[model samples]
Target: MGSCENQEFECKKQKPLLIEGPIIVGAGPSGLAVAACLKNNGVPSVILERNDCLASLWQQRAYDRLKLHLPKQFCELPLFGFPENFPKYPTKHQFISYVESYANHFSIKPIFNQVVEKAEFFQSIGLWRVKTQDFEYFSRWLIVATGENAEPMRPEIAGIEKFDGTVVHTSRYKSGSDFGNQRVLVVGCGNSGMEVSLDLCRHNASPYMVVRNTVHVLPREVFGFSTFGIAMALLKWVPLRLVDKFLLLAANFTLGNTDRLGLKRPKTGPIELKNATGKTPVLDVGALSQIRSGKIKVMNGVREITKSGAKFIDGQEKEFDSIILATGYKSNVPVWLKGSDFFTEDGLPKTPFPNSWKGEKGLYTVGFTRRGLLGTASDSLKIARDIADQWRTIKDTKNICNSQIALQM
Candidate 1:
């Protein structure tokens, strides 16, 4: 048993499993990115995933018609590119296949179904104790990649329990086919809400999209060019506000006045708002057309839920057969990772992007950057290189100590 071993973890075996590099939490894209980069640097890591398979949220929880909102180029992880044959915006299945190939290419296999109960750093020992259901993992570095969307944000609606209809979160929503021929109230205006309503319309369901707040809805592409790519290019030379103006102008010229239809624009520009608070603007695919066509009716905020329907703040009442909450997700880091100063109560790094990855006391986080997969790539590379450098220094120090002991003998 090591001197660091304590009553905190009475292992069946005396010693805890010491990882050679970092202990990466979550086998989602972010975790995989770190693991692959570590492997590239000849550092070994163990990935702990709570689910049975990788990308469980995408495969198990996401809707059937889901696809990457950003172009596939921006959505790819570190050290790998999406297949050249893939579309600019790949479908969910295509994306999953790419993930599998990426894992295979790097020979990165994660230990599945291992839920991390708690993780705390022992400063005296200069190691981290990563406790899971069955094993205790000790490592010099801990990489938290559980991600921003670790848990679904289920809002408390007034009289929700009394709502006598099919109620489910967007995570559990498989398809609109299940909601055919019913009046569905979708309580959001984000990409998911818009897409779900559009799907419902396709399935012959009456959908009322509740747009409670201002949203920045941009065309996924403008003039056959990726809107995001254009924004990135513009931001390099032009100011962010100028980029926002260009995007808004292009969106207005392309998509027409979305405000007239009900979804109003936020005073904060899309990119600026996204930067300030990790809120991503809704990238319009085909949902706006439905909203314009009046196939998807836009409604006000929900005031109260009735057994048969809902009463809006406008005092309008509509009978609905089902309610779909497209409320989005939050990080679950606070629930498991203990005694950490890296993350806030909301499970995001207190520090913002471009500097959010590396934390104190050998703690690192990926995908906490609101910047999405691009952020994952940046964090993964930096963390890998940093750990590799530190590992070499530690080995050199240990060798020096050993030589001193030999000389004394």
Candidate 2:
């Protein structure tokens, strides 16, 4: 109803664009999935992305050796499946291409390089004001799909600032070839840690993994079927404890007591761990083999970083040429919507990860709550259906009001 002059926030002072449908943030898979679903339901939306293109994490940040942790069937977007010729577990590049095809197939267009600097809700108008660098948008609904991996979670270690070796996060790590013949230490035993260590080994680099806590190291496949496939089938029917027990049994049968190899078996099941802590176990490709063969060494938690390398808590000091932190990332929610009651002080949802998918007050979050592509697709469908239902109700109410006014006239 009003232009940029009436907006509360101080922005670039340009004419504001008003939108009826949701203004989705981030052009990644979660954002794209929700937008496509809304469009299919006859509700158009706008996407604001900070990156140059869609799925920038997969396209630009991921390592060269990255592949889908889950099978392709489980990774497809809503109403779109991976090509028949694609691998069961598509590589990072293949997945990126599929995302591009999904966007093209749906004709979804996003405003590129538009980073939303601020967002404010106006309850009286039932609209939200979202401001970027150059423009401001007001929309009826706001969907924050900025995702969890947008910011890397770097840990502070004593003397790390003084260390002279190459330090990089997994997102910046292109390939192991760059550190040829160098001794490297990779902190954290998540998927990235395993994969990066394996890559470093392939490049003739001495890599050590720092396992600071209990970890579940699972074989990627058993009996030629993905372990993830088995979990999907049994996770619903079986109890969490039972599933954990079964997976532990399977892990032992597949890879001998990995605890003996320095990876202490976590008391909790892999699925439960992921559900609770949002940390998935390492699905081994070749990292386990190298670890078992003594090619890839394992270390305890770092006591402190030295000028050359790190000293472990076990009172062992090792010199390394570089340290690669596969330490994962935290949610960037506070950067835009800080002090909002929907999130905690740390920017995590007040409701745990599961309940975070459905938000109140015309606000919803997609990738922030979900785990993978399948979860994103499921959340997007639910969100689109909810929005469509609300739209239908408003339209019917408006029609009835207009008819009553005509009769009075």
lDDT of 2: 0.86
lDDT of each: 0.89, 0.86
Provide the clashing-pair count of each candidate structure.
0, 0
Candidate 1, pairs of clashing residues = none
lDDT of 1 by residue, 1-409 (tens): 3322212334463247776678899989998899899889877788888998788888888899999998888998888999999988899999889888888899877877678999999999999999888778888899999999999999988988999999999999999999999999999989899999999999999999999999999999888899999999999999999999999998899888888998889999999999998889989889988888889999999999999999999999999999999999999999998998778999999988788988899999998998889889999999999999998898899999999999999
| Most lDDT-accurate candidate | 1
Those runs of model 1 whose alpha carbons end farther than 4 Å from true positions after fitting are: 1-15, 399-409
Model 2: runs farther than 4 Å from truth? 1-13, 397-409
Report the C-alpha lDDT of model 2 over 1-409, residue by residue, as the tens digit.
4332122334445568887678898999999999989988988788889889999988888999999988898888998899999998899989999999999999888878888999878878877889888787998788989887888889988889989989999989999999999999999888899999999999999999999898899888888998888878887898877877877788899998998999997777888878887778888888899998888999999999999999999999999999999999887878887335887666666787556777677888888664788778888998999999988888899999999999999
